[model samples]
Target: MARRTTDINDIAFGVIRVRMRLHFMLTPKGDRQAVKYFVIGHPRNGTTTLHKLFVANGLNSFHDSRDWQTGRHDAFSDFGQLRPVAGYDRTYPNARFILNFRPLRHYLNSIATHHQKVFSVQNFINEAYRRAEYFAWALDYFKGRDDFIAVNIEAPGAVRAVADFWGFAVKEPPEGLINNVSTRPKLEQNSANIETALAALDLVEEAGRGCLVSRLNGARQTALLAARDTIRCVQ
Candidate 1:
């Protein structure tokens, strides 16, 4: 028979899943609470802004490429909160996840643009290979399970198309924003690019059954503020 087990905290370039295994609820004494949270997505999609918003709301959040490399952050290192809890999900299990989404060509362009700025003009194949490698890493992390929540700050149709193409797309954009439009950035979503992104998302989601907290890309500020409020509410 196939093994029927799920990893506690799994993450990659795409899906993130945390399994909540503890029945005991713990609090950080009095008014303060240590609720762990992570932001999962492409580099430029407002991860920095969200990190600031969480801090502004008095919630503890961390972000950095090194954070992942060193496994200093929960999403990378511990799988879950370093708290004493059984199973991956139950460990620092109270934390939530924020997954940002951007248009395909736009996302690709942003990465390519940044790569070029950092190094030199990159060839299309080089960019694609880098992106594919990132996606593969993400897929490795979210390889089996759900119990993690995701928030998308991109267009749903565009997101779906991209995820379908790339093999990721964990959760369908939430219900309310299904028809919502985002103004964040103007990018021509070519059919081919969309397909690639979608494929990536699908693969990630399959490995991990995560939910989608979709938001209109146009209302980035609103989304940031709302995320801040959410942290505050829990705090």
Candidate 2:
């Protein structure tokens, strides 16, 4: 003989099921806007700086390394990563891409300086030289795609060019390019050594041949001259 009574467990389970259904129904619409664009570039490039600019302009941009590490797929309007994440293009077919670069010499200098403690000098040199090949690969992989834009962050009016590409006016252009290693101490020796090594390998010329840097038109061309001038001033 058992006492007949309402089961509290049954009532709680029913409430949870109803809430779960509501959550799933409301999620897809929000996820649709996630990862609208990817800033595909290497470390010591301007990815972080550009991300700051995008946020300043009221766009929700995130650095994706943390997301990748935590196995989270949360959405954001923009995503910046040090290197291309495999399968992202196939997964996000409609997402746009920004190919960002800097002069190879300067890029190497920045990398060697910033990571001097993290990597051996020989390892640093090897890694810096490899970046050119990586850049070339990325350029060829995305060639002829109207959804991508290559930008040299050191260029003048780069922020303007980015805004134009997106078809949105910025509230204000970024103050200046950020995260330079020029002022970092103990870099002078590394810079000289890296320059000599690059010249010996002709890496700079090789990088220049990459379509991303070689093919520039309209505003990008103007920006190239500005970039050269900026580099000259810095040196």
Candidate 3:
């Protein structure tokens, strides 16, 4: 009994030490030693869904929902502008960029819904353009990075898109997308913006040597799991 107790204590101590090490590695020492990952995408397109996922998993993930609703200038800027402020380069010394991609039409509809919810239809057209610009900037930024993983969902033949999107990335796709009722396609500009944003992430993933995880629906649980896995893997 004494020997078994000792063994159990040793195992507990080992687990605690591992957890401590993980916590320490996650926090950057200084600005120069920091690493930040930006989840850049136009309004909607599951950015919030991803944000919720990360938070749910107890990772240091930021989800500024106001960036989409209010005319808040923070989320209005291009990826380059938001990149430094978002501190993707400073938050983690070693980070992976998880880029989400969707169809153009479906993306636009999301934008419209966002606008309606916020009652900003008065200047809707201009806001849409601004959002598109941001997405373009994000794509350019993602493409420039070598450490990004681009996950494209709209692309057909991507049976595992939804699962991958949820951060599970199983070899086989789960059942659902086919039987699920499809929503209306997004607007042209919104679609374009999503395409541009995804393209940028693809470039970053290619350069970063990171793996892509895809899924059909961007759920909170998936984001949290992905975030936890990402932080663990990166750290």
Estimate, for each residue in 93-201, the C-alpha lDDT of model 1 and write its tens digit: 4544443544334445555444432221223323333333333333333433242333334533533432242233342323323322233443334334433443544
Superposed model 1: Cα runs more than 4 Å off: 1-34, 68-90, 117-147, 155-235
Name the 10 consecutive residues with the lowest summed lDDT in model 3.
69-78
For each predicted model, how many residue pairs clash, with residues at least 3 apart or on different chains?
Answer: 34, 0, 31
List the candidates ranked by TM-score, beginning with the highest. Answer: 2, 3, 1
lDDT ranking of the models: 2, 3, 1
| Model 2 regions lying over 4 Å from their true place | 1-35, 68-86, 118-125, 171-177, 180-183, 203-235
Better of 1 and 2 by TM-score: 2
lDDT of 3 by residue, 1-235 (tens): 0001123324653565455445434654344433334455443545544444444434455555322211111111112223332344344445445555454435444555444333222233333333334434444445445555444434543424433433543434233233212365435564444444444333223312222222211243354344434321221
TM-score (C-alpha, index-matched) for candidate 3: 0.38
Q: What is the TM-score of each candidate against the true structure?
A: 0.37, 0.61, 0.38
TM-score, predicted candidate 2 vs. hidden true structure = 0.61
Query: lDDT of model 1 at residue 39?
Result: 54
Q: In angstroms, how far off is 130's CA in candidate 2?
A: 2.0
